[model samples]
Target: MYRLVLLVLLALPLAGCFAPRAEDTARNWRPMGANGLALGRLVALSPGVTRATWEAFAGIKGQTVVRLAAEYDPVRAAAGCPPPEAGMVRAARSFLIVDLAVTPQKSVDFIAAKAQAYSADGYFEEYDLDIGVIAALAARARPMPCADLALPGYLR
Candidate 1:
């Protein structure tokens, strides 16, 4: 009887260990480490891949869902850390593109806030890097607050 009682106590703790923890719904960004940049590099390396094949290769059924967000390298820089290397910047940029593709509104909102904080320079840099973002905004009839200035012909 004592053995069974101890066994039951041990199993009870095991059961508690397997219990699900609460999900953090408020946090939208997820870190994917090096794995996060793989898809972007693949796309960059290979062009004209058929949608079906790409979809099959990147099927979500067995894959983990990762939502990329802006990197906090600035905070690290403030702490005396060196600026991110080219690969890290590429990963961050790729992640931002994925975020823009998957969640346009959220991405735009984030970009807009950044633009507001940093002024037209932020928008100009973002626009220069990715025209797709501006196109996405236009397609959705969303206002581009950062386009407040009369950009030169070169920028247009």
Candidate 2:
């Protein structure tokens, strides 16, 4: 399995939302536990910096990997995505609680380690994603490196 620097997201198709719901706004994202949710493939290649970013955003004290998986079934994602879209990744639709994070690189390492769960031979389930979206998020995000998170599970 392979890790991606960026992925897709989905919302009300933009355009003013047509008929917005109270829950649609980011203001009302209720907290949900991380238990029993379908775990997505963790592509941890660069855990160090990714964990740093997550810690900063999550306002936590320790290094943390912030997984952003969709509430819907990952299979429901486009049958084949090339560059993935913000609309394709549904953050507002769900929440990704911390799975585990011991050090800075712990997150990316987990992502890379979990590749098999979501990919085969190196192709990702979101491989059908569009390049534009992936490129944009890559440009926008402060991605950590694969090496930072490459330790074996025993190390943790």
The C-alpha lDDT values of all candidates are: 0.27, 0.25
Candidate 1 per-residue lDDT, tens place, 89-110, comes to: 2111111222222221122112
Candidate 2 structure quality by residue, lDDT tens digits, 76-122: 22223233332232211111222232233222212211111122223
Clashes of each: 0, 34
Worst 10 residues of 1 by lDDT: 48-57
Quality of model 2 by C-alpha lDDT: 0.25
Q: Give every collision pair in model 1.
A: none
